[model samples]
Target chain A: MSEFDLIRKHLTGIGARRDDVVVDLGDDCAVLRVPHGRELAVSIDTLVAGVHFLPDCDAESLGWKSLAVGLSDLAATGAEPAWATLALTLPAADEAWLAAFCRGFAELAAAQDVRLVGGDLTRGPLTISVQVHGFVPAGHALRRAGARPGDLVCVSGALGDAGLALRHLQRGEPLDDYLRRRLERPVPRVELGELLRGLASAAIDLSDGLVADLGHILAASGCAAWVELDRLPLADQVAGVVAGQAAGGADWGLPLASGDDYELCFTLPPEHAAELSVLAAAARCPITRIGEVVPGSGLRLLTSDGHPWAGTVAGYDHFHG
Target chain B: MSEFDLIRKHLTGIGARRDDVVVDLGDDCAVLRVPHGRELAVSIDTLVAGVHFLPDCDAESLGWKSLAVGLSDLAATGAEPAWATLALTLPAADEAWLAAFCRGFAELAAAQDVRLVGGDLTRGPLTISVQVHGFVPAGHALRRAGARPGDLVCVSGALGDAGLALRHLQRGEPLDDYLRRRLERPVPRVELGELLRGLASAAIDLSDGLVADLGHILAASGCAAWVELDRLPLADQVAGVVAGQAAGGADWGLPLASGDDYELCFTLPPEHAAELSVLAAAARCPITRIGEVVPGSGLRLLTSDGHPWAGTVAGYDHFHG
Candidate 1:
């Protein structure tokens, strides 16, 4: 069958609302009416083969990772996941590959209740470009510019597992099954974002390492942050990796600078920390208080002994080596 | 300078309003709070080098065309253009190319009052992906499914110049100055679409050829259409090309199926035709009634003598040869 036929037969069965979509698949353009009283939050992310993932990566993981990356944006801003459009470039329209991709994509999209509204399938080297849209009430969404000088910084879940997974894959080290799973499927904290709405003074997602990403919030809000390095909640698996490698000086480097965590990093006034703890307990997710925003210009890391610990900044840059 | 530096310097100049954009460009996500009572219209388009444009095509035109292609989607839904995010992939960060692209992008964006909100820059073969967001009053946006059997099919602006321009470049045919300009610069019918909002029963953008693109409306609305071949609005320069290539046949196949016109194709009741004509006159763009929806399936094209005209479908298809 042709690609168009394949799309109609297999991919279009994801149960998107036909009535809400003015134009669905198989059109020059897709027309959708935003429902009344909702503002649209939009984001786009492109994952290239060899750059974003390995050549031997499973199609299911790729589809899951593609949506997870885009959804992480919505999660960071406390926007409810709504619609997604995919632009797929492939070497050829291999039916098996397409089926696996659609299966994985549909599974994740269904879990988040995100509708697969429209997309483009083209001929080229393998690449997945996903644009996700979410809706938030006017003035109710979280932002990076709202943090004040005395706000406490917090992160959802443990950090460094994803970065360590990448390192393990690169070094040809045998990864424990847990670390491998974390790398293949990083969960986006969507529900936690919604719970943090009206609570987080400012927020961002950990796509680039925490320090670099938090530096964005600091720069935008014109405040500095002081992170207690010893207080960081590293994954047990990551700690095991560090212990196995026998690197004793500092294992926090990869977790702090390595990216692709897809977790929420946010801030709240110190007064709200108690309330936030209750909220985190209800959500069943661990919220780590990593630092506090201060009136200054750069991020400072504090050692357990109360001295400043200088570390190298090592986040992913597309154009930089 | 690297692409990241160029974005930090030039592209970031598109100001972000803290009130409107919850999370601005510097963060992992940009949050937009949708105002109450407004629906968000979203669309995405990707233009790849050697596929969407010639490798040596002017960088400025590439920028303009990329935005135009995406904005055309907004026009089809009768949405007011608001903001845009771009994903640019380059083989290398060339300073001159980046400057030209930013100039062209900013020029069109400023003219439309569309904010350059957020985007990603990456390393790869040159590709320009733009996802545009627009707003329309809740439930008031035009759609392709609303066309009734008796609705008149209308199109805004002239057709076939982009395709003819490509042919001229390919065959080394000397293009008149007007035709060259038309090919290089496509004027999207944004204003005309606004005028059509309450008038058009259903609408679509002419990116694919009229027959294929219009077929979308027919299929969705469960109606057939009969178009008069003589009524197609071909540019004067395109007429000259047709005259020169008389051996190609009387049907003017280039205008019939050559894509990239970016005109608005809409359907309206016969009673609204006069008001549409007035609106088109005020906008200084021609509105031509090329076809009428009928009670059946499939599209039929008739010559002045009312006979079927056989022309090949010359519009673009990614999977087809």
Candidate 2:
């Protein structure tokens, strides 16, 4: 099929239709109107086969994950996503694969009310680049450099599930269906992020593990933090794995350093922390207080007994890792 | 180097800095305040090694072309360029190559006053995906579906130089320096595009050859066109090559069907067409009147004597060509 035919047949008319999208798909440029009194938040992410995902992974899951990754960044900024542009590179035009991929993409895009505006498709080794645009109320964007000392550090949703799932998949070990789902289908914390807008002092989505992502907040905010290791909300399977390991073993690092969590690690003042129950209910997710920001630099891990916990902590580096 | 380190050392602190940028690189998402009374124009284009470009081409040229391709889309819409996000997938982190690439990217970005806002870097076979965001006055953005039957067809700048350059490179033949520069550094008609906003009836950038790109405008506008083939504004080298060939030879196909011209093809009413000299002077580029839009379907070509001229005119399609 010609490039235009391929787009018309498989990739068009499959996403949310928003009135704000003045011009979409068929045009050279998609013209969109950002609402009055709102600022535009934009982010882009790229996923490559065999590096970001297994080369033989299901096309549908890859599609969902590709957009999810970009949405996660917007979520961190408390932006309500409105549009996305996808640049897809493939070895060939596989009709069945394209159909499944579009189905997966449309599902999440529909939920978030984001329109697929414009994109480019080319022939190459499989790679997907998604750029998401969203809107946030003026002066209300959640940033990583706003945290202050004595504030409370919190996280939404359980951590380490996706990373542990990757471990099992790599080993070819049988894993529970929940772990499989966590690995392939991550949910961006969109509602939680919007809820945190005025309340949270600093926020970031956990992609490169808790220790690493939290470190970013601390570095940007110029403050230290102490995470109570036992307070971490690990996935059920991840908790079991931790229990099976010796204290301070390398496995203890799973919840701290394994990447792809897609959870929000945020900080809020002590007064706002008291309203966690109300905020969690509104977000439809559990919000947990796991640590506190301090007047120093770098992140410190503390055990239940309040002693520093020593374990390997490294963020995922696409180039050197 | 770590992924974060690579970005910090090579990709940060370059490009234009605009007052609208509320939060830029190092944030989860870049936040920008779009001026009131404007609409956002976004477009994405991907260049994969060995597909959109030569795998071993100069890194600086590749970087410039990468951003140029996406900016060309914005130019077609008569949008003022604002922000750009680059998703770069590289086989490895070669510092020297990266520095050169960033230099090229920054050159065009600074000239257009476009800021490098947010992006992702990943490990994979070389691929560059650039998503550009620009702004146009609400209701003033140029589109491809507004042409009327009586409008005059026009194009900014010469054609076929880039295509001929590619042909010479592919065959290891000697080519002029001008052709080489045209192939390496295509100037997107940003000024000309904005100048035609209120005057042009329809607009599109020449990427997939004149025949194909113009076909898009015709299909969308539900009109046909008749081109006086001899009136086409061919580049000096392209004209010389045409002179060296027989009548209706493949060389004629070069100027008609070879892609990668990144020039603006537009339509305007006869009254507006009369002001071409003024527009050209303001745009600082040659504006040639090549044809006229007409009722019916598909494009018709005529020689200087009004005889039908038929030659192969297939557009460049990555999947099929």
Candidate 3:
């Protein structure tokens, strides 16, 4: 059978609401109607093998990671997940691999109420690209330019677990279930973002390490941040790893600069901190106030002693040594 | 500098309208507002190094072709082009190459009034994936399942020129300026599709070979079609290429199944044929009535003598020998 036939027969079973989707899987394009009063938020992320993930990574994890990464972007914008289009490139159409991958992808997508709208499947070295769309009310979406100089910088959940998970995976260390699951399925704080939409000032997702990703908010808002290194919400497992390490001082840089946290980092005025605490309690999610935005142009890390904490600023750079 | 820095410094200046774009480049996601009465049309296309085009294809042409392919989908839905996000993966970030690619990308984007909303630049084998979003009036978008039996099948401009252009490029054939230009720059019938929005029953862009791509309409609409081979609209240069071939028999199939035409193929009711002709004339584009939909399930090709013409299907397929 031809490629078109294969896709029509085997891959078109992914469910999407047929009512609002005028054109579905087999068409050249999918036509969707955004209800009035809603704005569309779209994001695209491409995960290349040996770069974004391990070449030998499980196909199921790869599929889950693909959707998770894209959904993280929607979470950052406080947009409700709606539709997604996947573009998959593989060396060949292995039916077994495709089935496993689709199963994982469908599970995650269904959990988030995201529909698989349409996409292209082709032959190449394994690469997965997903473009996710979300809907947000007009004038209600969060942005990175709304933060003020005196706003408190906050992050959702513990950091450095995903980075440390990578190191564990690389070192072939048998991670405890908590660390392994954190790496495999990092939950994006989508609901928390919605709760904080009108409350938070600037917001961004931590994908390229806390320092670099948070730098985006500072740059966009034309402000600087003073982060208290001691106050970072580190994962218990990561803290255990840090304590067990030999005197390589401040190896916690990975937790600080490691990408793939998929956590939301935002800013709120000092006066809103109490309300934020109440909101976090209601949501049952940890919301950490790590620092405050200041009037400047660059990020500064402060030690508990009120001195600058100088550590390696290295992070994932797409095209560099 | 890294790819991220290069994009921040250079590739970001692609005429992005940042005022209305809630989240522009350098963010996890970009957010934009859809006007009240407009429905969003989204499409994606991925071009791999050796699969979609020649290995050494001009960077500018690659960029233009990538955007053009995605726009063709929007055009088929009669959506007014609005925004595009490009994900570019390169083995290495070459400054000159990126400059040329951005120039070509921005040129076409500006022509269609499509804003460069957001995207990512990553490190991997050369792959350019573009996701485009457009807007159409609510309940006015065209679709592939809207074709009814007895509708007149029509196509815009000529077909098979792009396929032949690729063949010539592969054979290293010395061609006139027109054929070479056809291969490099395909003019998608965006305006013609917009004009046919309310008139055409079912519409699709001819990206794959005419026979195969049109088959999508037939399958979706549950209709059969009888295409008159003699009435096909062929470019003058394509005709010359056919005449130059020693045996026209095999070459005739190239135009039918060779994809990458990027023209609009649509169905219109017989009662609207004359109106469509007038509309096509007003749009300054030729609309050829090459077939008619029938109450059946298979496509048939008829010669002037009314005999079935059996030919090879030559369009690009991801998996098939």
| Number of the predicted model whose DockQ against the real structure is largest | 2
How many backbone clashes are present in model 2?
Answer: 0
- Tell me how far the alpha carbon of residue B205 in candidate 1 is from the true structure, in angstroms, after superposition: 1.1
Q: Where does model 3 exceed 4 Å of error?
A: A9-20, B13-20, B243-250
Give TM-scores for every candidate, taking all chains together and pairing residue i with residue i: 0.91, 0.98, 0.95
What's the lDDT for residue B298 in model 3? 74
Model 3 misses residue A44 by how many Å? 1.3
lDDT of each: 0.78, 0.90, 0.81
lDDT of 1 by residue, B1-321 (tens): 544466787667562233556555655556675555666677777777777778898887777777888788888878777788888877787878877887777777877877777778777777777887777776677777778888998888887888888888878778677676666667777887777778888888987778777887888788999998788888877777666765776646667677788888999998897787688887688888998999998789887788887665655676663
Over the stretch A164-234, how does candidate 3's per-residue lDDT look in tens digits? 88888899977777776667777777888788778899888888889888888898899999998878898
> A1-321 in candidate 1: lDDT tens per residue?
654566677667553454556556544445565556555677788887777788778898888888999899888888888788887777777889888888888888888887777666766667778888787766677887788899999998888888888888888989887777678788888888888888898898998789878887888789999999878888887766544644545656667878888888999988888887787887678899989999987789888787897556656776774
Candidate 1 fraction of reference contacts recovered: 0.41
- Candidate 2: which pairs clash? none
CA error at residue B100 for candidate 2, angstroms:
0.7
Q: Point out the higher-scoring one by TM-score: 2 or 3.
A: 2
In order of lDDT, best first, we have 2, 3, 1
Clashing pairs in 3: none
Name the weakest run of 10 consecutive residues (lDDT summed) in model 3 chain B. Answer: B242-251
How do the residues B1-321 of candidate 3 rate in per-residue lDDT, one tens digit apiece?
866688787667575454557656666677787777777788888888888888899988877888899889988988888888888888887888888888888888888887877778888888888988887888888888888889999998888888788887899987677766677777767788788778899999987778888888899899999998878899877776655763756356667877888889999998897797687887788889999999999788887688887665655687763
Q: Residue B205 of candidate 3: its Cα lDDT?
A: 92
